[model samples]
Every structure is written in structure tokens, then in C-alpha cells.
Target: MRSLFQTYVHGSISAVLGPFRRYLPAVVLLGLLATALEGIGIGLVIPLLDVVVSGGSDAQGFLPGLLVSFGETVPRETRGLLIGGAILALLSVKNIVVYANGLLQAWIYGQAGHRLRTALARKLTAMDASDLLSEPPSRMLNIISNESWRSADAVAAVMGIMVNATAALILLAFLMAMSWQLTLVVLLGIAAIQFAHERMSQHFAGLSKIITDQNRGLAGRMLHLVAAWRLIRLFGREDFEEDRFAQASDSVRLAALDLQKRQMAVAPITEIAHATLFMAVIFFAWSLGITFGTAAAFIILLYRLQPQVRQIQAGLAALRGWTGSLDEVQWLMTAAPAEPVTSGHLPAPALTRGLAFEQVSFHYAGAAADRPALHDATFEVPAGTSLAIIGRSGSGKSTMAHLLCRLLEPTSGQILVDGTPLSEIDRVDWLAHMAVASQELELFDGSVTDNIRYGAPEADETRVLEAARQADADEFIRSLPQGYDTGVGDRGLSLSAGQRQRIALARALVREPRLLIMDEATNAMDLLSERAALRILEHRRGKGTTLVISHHLSSITRCDRFIRLDRGRIVESGTTMDFNEEQLARMLRTTGT
Candidate 1:
């Protein structure tokens, strides 16, 4: 019991509830006031028993004797009425304080939940893009959105334990004053019962872990349903998915049912124990030749003390049940990448003179050192010029593009902006002046205008329309059911892949960034649309530099200069005129570009 209390109260709950710790003093004061009022009411019970049951003659013991002496100071005729009214008044005040304390605890619970969710979001944003990508999206979302609430409930359980223990201890003091010998026996018996009950709490901790794991699996399955429903339908896996989901759900239901069974059993078992203790107290009183009024008052106090003791046991069980989730919450808040993302204090990068890759190379974690994803390759793109990268799938074309965009860093070499290393620039400040449209397009659930404006929030309607026209998206967008106001479904799946590509391009162009990168951005567009998009690229020359990665021969031929990668190494570089259509086709065949 002592170990569990110390681990949760002083350990698990401490960091989880740190933000709300300062408010505990006020909670303690309100709890103390409520307990004091309850103790006072329990003290008055003996005087009431004397007036109503013993005809004001049978009062005994220290508390009853004190009340008896006070009763003597009052007129005997009205004493009974005064004592009963005072009891009701003290109870009413105690209930009021208890209500306020409940509200305070609720506020703490809400704030704790809110802060945890927001902090998780901030932590994810602060992480390196590669580190964030390594996390399972479904499990991360479940922890932030669902498990956080369960953890916050643990904080409420801790507060409940504290308040209930305070009331229980103060009521025990009342019992001790009335009859120390009986109080000793009662305390010892209750201690044994709690000791046995601690074993049940140990079981709850295990059950809580089962429930947490099962719920995480269930959440992952549900997310798969939302994200891949189309694929499920296309593959005709409806029945299979249903069976898998049912199994996951049943695991959660069974584990949760077992946990609830133990928790609900707590109150009833404590009730039976208290009833037995009640009978034992009466037998002890009779053996000692105790009066009816004094014994009656003691029983009344013990009955009132029953719920406080019951709450203490139940609260501890609940804390054990939720502390499993609380541990997860704490882990999420403190978990960090093996190495922090390298951030520099330099100002945003400037692409004034040119950009250079000085023997840049990269490989993903855990891959063979010799089989690097991108081998040592060097290139340069001067300001106000365009560079094209052409390679077949798995040639590390995308890796090189990501490096230039600062989404991933090269393993051994440096990428320089003008004369500065890319890592030295402020990431966020530099990204504001850059725009990228890639094959993995992400369109939010909103209108075409909203998606386009996402690239430049301050873009006016004229600029939005111009960018759309440049990407050859304006005609199709205007033909939609609601024109610019049409809502795209999740991930913009409601639109064709080609339509989404153009919208993504429009989004990139709306920003008028100093640097633009397009990786397989036109693969989904028809031949005419692809050519028109390239024409738009040609029109914007000299304003800034453009980097294009495509398997299309036309896209390669249109650029000012091009680099060809094969097996993660740059194999060739030259101007567009260096290769005729036949030579480009022969080169593409030999290099698998």
C-alpha cells in the first residue's frame, strides 16, 4: 500500500499534473473546511441522541459529556430543537464546500487534458520531419486524442483520494475522542480490510494495461478503415475487414468489462465489511456496559465514516486503472528523437548567387553503408536559371530533391545557399520563400480557392485566378458544382488525380516563391496539360530558379540544363541541346530513366 501510494501520488501523478499543481493549495483548503464541518456534525450526534432517544439523561464519554455540559447552559425546553437544527445547518455548509471542491477538481481535469493534447501537437511540430515520419500516425493520434482523457481522469482520482482521506482521518479523530478503546479496534480491522483490497488494486493495474493496448489496436484498425476504404471496396475485402475489426473491438470490450467488474465490486464489498463491523461495535459496547445513547451516537458516526473509507478504496483502484494510460501520456510528453533536429541561429537563406551540392550523399537509417540511397554527386544551379533532374524510379531523384528542399539532409556533404550552408538557415523563415509541388500531393478538405490560398494566405482573388490559369486548373475549377466554393473531400479524393495535381501546382505558383521545385508534379496531367504547365514554367524564367524532376522527355528537353541519375549517382549533365530526341531515347533506354 505504501509503495503504490508513493509511486503514483509522488511519482506518476507529479509530472502529469505539474501544470495544475499550484492550484492544489486551494483544493486542500476547501477539502479541510468540508472535513471540519463533517467532524463537527459527527460530534453533535451524541447530544441529539440524548435529547430525542435518552430523554436528555444518558449522555456519556468525552464528546457527549461536553455536549451535555453545553446543553445545561441552554433552556431545557428548547434544547432538542436547537441541537437538531444545528446538525442540519452544519451538513448544509459541508455539502456546499464539497460542491466547490468538486468544481475545482473538474477544472483541473479539463485543463490537464487540454494542455496534454496541445503539448503533444507542439512536440510533433518541433520534431525533425524524418523523426516524425518514423512514428505510426494511427497510434500517435490515438494517444493524443483518446488516451489523454483517461490519463486526465487519473488526476481527478488522485484529488478524490486526498479529499476522502482527509475526511476519514478527521472523523477517526472524533471516534477516538469519544472512545479510544473502541477506535483502536475499529482502526485495526479497517487497516486489514484495506490491505486485502490493495491486492485487488494490483489486479486493476494489470487490467488497465490490457485495456490500453487493446484500445490502441482498435484505434489503428478504425483509422485504416477511414484511410483505405476505397482500396477495401476495390479489393472486395468488406467481410474480412469486418471480422478483423470485430476481433479488435471484442478484445477491448472484454478487458474493459473485467476492469469495471472489479471496480464496481469495491463498494459492495466495503458495505458488507462495514455492516459486519457495525455489529461488532454494538457487541463491544454491550460488553463494556455502555449506555444506549452513547453507543447509538458512536454507530451514527461510524456509518457516516463508511463512505469516506469506501471512496478512498474506490479512488485508489480507479487511479491504478488509469495510471497505465498516465504513464503513456508522460512518455509522449518526454519522448525525443535520438538526436535533436539541428537548428541554426542564422537568418533565412538567400538564393542570390546560386545553390550548390558539394559531393552530397545520403542513406536512410539501417540500410547497408555500401548500398546508400544516394551516393556522392555534385551539381550547381545558378540564380534565375532552371535545372532538371531525370532518372527512372529508385534512382534517388526524390532524395536529392528532398535534400535541396531541406526536408532531409545529406549524410556526408553540404548544400549551400549562395555561400551559406543550408543547415545554417532558419528552417521556417527560409520555407516562407520556397514552394514545392510533388507527386505525393496533399489537398485539405476545403474549396479550390482555399487550397490555392494555402500557399499564400494573403493572395487576392486576382492572383489566385492567375495562378490557377497558369497551372491550367481555372477552367476545370470554374466548371465544378460550386466553382471555387466546392468542398473537396478528405485528402481531395473527390477530385481526379490529374485535377488534384493541377490544384497543387496552382497552390505552388500562387506564392510566387523565390525558389520552386516540382517532383513528378505533372505525371498525372494529360499531354496538353503537361505541355501547358511547362510553358507556364518557361514564362516565369529569370525571376528565380526552378528545379524539375520528371521522367518525361519533353520536361527534360525544356529545361536550360539537366542531370541524369542512375543507381543513386549522377551519371551525366549538360544543356538541353546536347541530346537530340533519338539520343535522349537511347540514353533513357541504357540508364533506365
Candidate 2:
């Protein structure tokens, strides 16, 4: 429990002070000034009560001593009015300062939130591709959108704790000056209640961890349901999914209830402790022959003190609740020490010569050591030449593509681009010269033109139309109600599978890359449409390099060269013309296509 509190408090401070360190001193100063003003206002209550009791008699105690020294020539009536005016003035100044402090804190909070979110995003972008692939998308989404915001809320809670704690301390100082004996008794009683509350509240941190896990689980399940809605309905598993979701939600509900119960107990326990202390203090003062007016003033001060103490306790509880989120944000921001994708200082040159893989071998992390994904695979594609890699599933076709794209580094051998080591070229520049379209299509909720222009945003309208025509999507796009302006629903659900693929193809083509990669990009299209797509590739045959990863036999016949992979090894390599009808049939049969 002590560790939990320390973690939360440290995280909250690091998040707030680390991002907004420059303005923190100013914010602290404002808080102190506001707290001082509040203390002065509370202190004036005793003098007002004294004036009322003695019918505007001369001021008493330390205040009177100061006022008499400061205003000997001032009249008594004027002095009383001045004191009343000073109290009002002090309260009015405190209100203004409080409002200003709120504005500054808000500014700091907004700045810190923006900084943290931006830094998280940048860190994710800079992370290694392998690390990113190992993580679940739902977890990343939850941390970026949900946990990051909660971290910002934690900052606000910390600031509240500071403000309230300061106010309580200043008020306590005023109370002690008024009557030391009574103030000491009240302090002791409040301390005892706070200690008990802390003991009971220890469970909140664990409960919060449970709620965080449940929320992430629920979010993952919800995403699965939405993405696989058709399958769920086809299998008639609606009730099953509902039950799973309900179970997750119920866990969250129970955890929240337990935390709330512990938190809600603080108020009543503190109130009881305060009321009993007030009664005991009154009896003790009466026994000591304290005056009624003094007793009444002290009671008013104690009443004001209770709320500040409560605010302090509530702020502490809120901070504890946010500990889990802070931990998540910290995890998201920290990157593991792994091999990164881009680490070169030299700019990537144009692929004028060719790309070559020299005895390349790669094994995924945690994969069977003996069964590597790609083993001793060696190939070369000369510039302005096309190469088709045909293999059955689990034969390392996709792994080769990933290696070519620099998404995965080769474990044993080097990949050279134009005779330069691939790792020595800047990744961003290398990627800018290449484009890929895979079996998985990623289309945002936008218009046809927006999706096509995603890769080459500055492409002119003429270029976009040409790219669409090249992908055989222009006619279908024109048939829509708004043509290029028509909106595609989320994930392009409003479009057919072929339409989405064509749009993705168009996105790749619009970049006019030096190397174009198509990994089963036309599987959804019909035979005629697939033939038409291949015709477009035929036009770009000698103009630039192309890598076609497909099981379809017809898709590879036009390539300049072909390679057959089986069990992570290259089984054969030659031009399509070199293979006889029998050999081609056997290759197709071996690949099951």
C-alpha cells in the first residue's frame, strides 16, 4: 500500500512537472498567494465576533496590537468599519486569485496533456516494427486514447491536492494561534481518523488495477465483435458474445463498487471524529473558564477547517484511483531495447542497379528454432525487371516481402540495394521509393479520392484520375452518386471487396514508386477483373521493378523471372518461358493453384 501511494504520487508529479516545468513555479506562487488570502479572511472572523460581542469595542489580541500601532490617530468607529471592509477586501482578493489560479492550472493541464499525447504518438512511430507487431492493437488504442487522458486527469488531481493541502495548513496555523489547547485536540482527533481512512483505503489501488484490466478486455472484445459481425451472426453467437461482454462489465462494476464503498466511508468517519472532537473541546474550554465569544469564534474556524480536510482526503483518493492509468501511460511511452527498423545516417539512393538478398535467413521471435520462416533464401531482381515469388501458405512468401520492405531485418545475411547494404540507407527515403498493396486493405472513412490520394497527397486531379483508371476503378467510381466525392463508410464498409481492393491498388499506383509490390492484391476480383488488373501491370513491366507474391498461376506468367519457395527454401528459379507445360502443371499442382 505504501508502494502504491508512492507510485501514484511520483508518477503524478513526474507527469505534471516534467512537461510543464517552466510554468510550475508561477503556478505554485499563485496557489500560495490564494491560500494566504483565504487564511487572512478566516482569521478576520474572530475580530468580527469580538466587535459584535462588545458592541464595537476596541479590537483585541494580536490584530488589535498591530492595528493600534498602525492606526493610533484613527477613530474607533472608523476602525471597526475598516476592519469589516478589510475582511471583505481580503475575501474578494482571494476569489480573484482563486479564479486566476484555476485559469493557470487549466492552461498547464492542457499543455501537459498535449505534450504527453504527442510524445506518446511520436514514440510509437519510432518503435521497431517487430515490437509493434507483437502488441495488440486494442491495448495500444486504449493506452493512446483512454489511458493518456486519465494521466492528464491525474495531473489535475495532484494540483488539487497541493491547493487543498496548502489551504488546510494555513487555516490550521490560524486556528493554533487562536487557541493552542483546543486546536491540538482537534488535530489529534483528525489525524487518528485520517490514519484509519488510509488503512481502509489501501484496497482502492488494487481495485483500480482490476477496473483497468477489465476495461481493456471489454474494449478488445467490442472491437472483435464489430470487426467480425458477419461471422458472429452466421454462427448465431450473439448471446455468447453478450455474455462475455456482460461478464467483463460485471467485473468492472463490482470493482468500482468496492472502491466507492471504501471512498464513501471516509466522509462519515471524519465527520463523526470531528463532531466528537468539537464536543470534547467545548467541554474542556468550559472547564477552563474560556469566554463564550472565544468559543463561538473557535467553533466557526473549526467548521471551515473540516471541509478543507475533506478536500485533501478526497484529492488523495482520486490520485490513488489514477495510479493504474499512470502506470499504463508510462509503459506506453517507454520502448523496449530491440533492433529498430531505421538506424542509418546515409540517404537512400535510387534503385538504379538492383536489389539482392544474399543467403538471407529470418526466424520470428519465439518461433520454433529448427523451423525458421525463411532459410538461406537468395535472390536478385535487376532494376526495371519484374519478379514473381509463388509459394503455398507457410512457405515464407510473405516473410520475403516483409524483408524486402525493411519491416523485418534478416537474421543471418545482408540485403543490398544498388550494391549498398539496405541497413545503411535511410528507411524513410527507401520507403518513399516503394509502395505495397497486400491482402489486407486499410481504407479510412473517407471519399474515393481521399483514399486514392492518401499516399501522394499532393497529386493533381489528373494524376489521381489516371491512377484510378490504371487500377480499373474509374468506371465504378463514376457510377457512384457523388463520383469521387462519395463517402466510404468506416473501413470502407460501404464498398464491395473488389472496390476496396481497387482503391487500395490505386493508392499504391498514385505514388509512382520505383518498386511496386502486390501481395495477393487481386484475390477478391473476378477472373475478368483480375485479368484487367494484370494488363495494367504489363504496361509497367520494363519501366520499373515489380514484386508479385501470389498463388494464381496467370499472375506470374508475365513476370521477367519467377521463384518457387517450399518450406523456407528456394526450390526453383527461371523465366516462365523456360518451363514446359508439364513442368508448369507440376509447379501449379505443388502450390495448390
Which of the numbered candidates is closest to the native, going by highest lDDT?
1
Q: What is the lDDT of residue 232 in candidate 1?
A: 100
State the lDDT of candidate 1 residue by residue for 272-372, as single tens digits: 88788878888898888777767776777888887889888887777778756766676677766423355456876567788888888898766688877
Every model: Cα RMSD to truth: 3.7, 3.5
Candidate 2 per-residue lDDT, tens place, 164-198, comes to: 77777776776676667777888888888789767
Clash pairs for candidate 1? none
Worst 10 residues of 1 by lDDT: 336-345
Residue 563 CA error for candidate 1 (Å)? 5.8
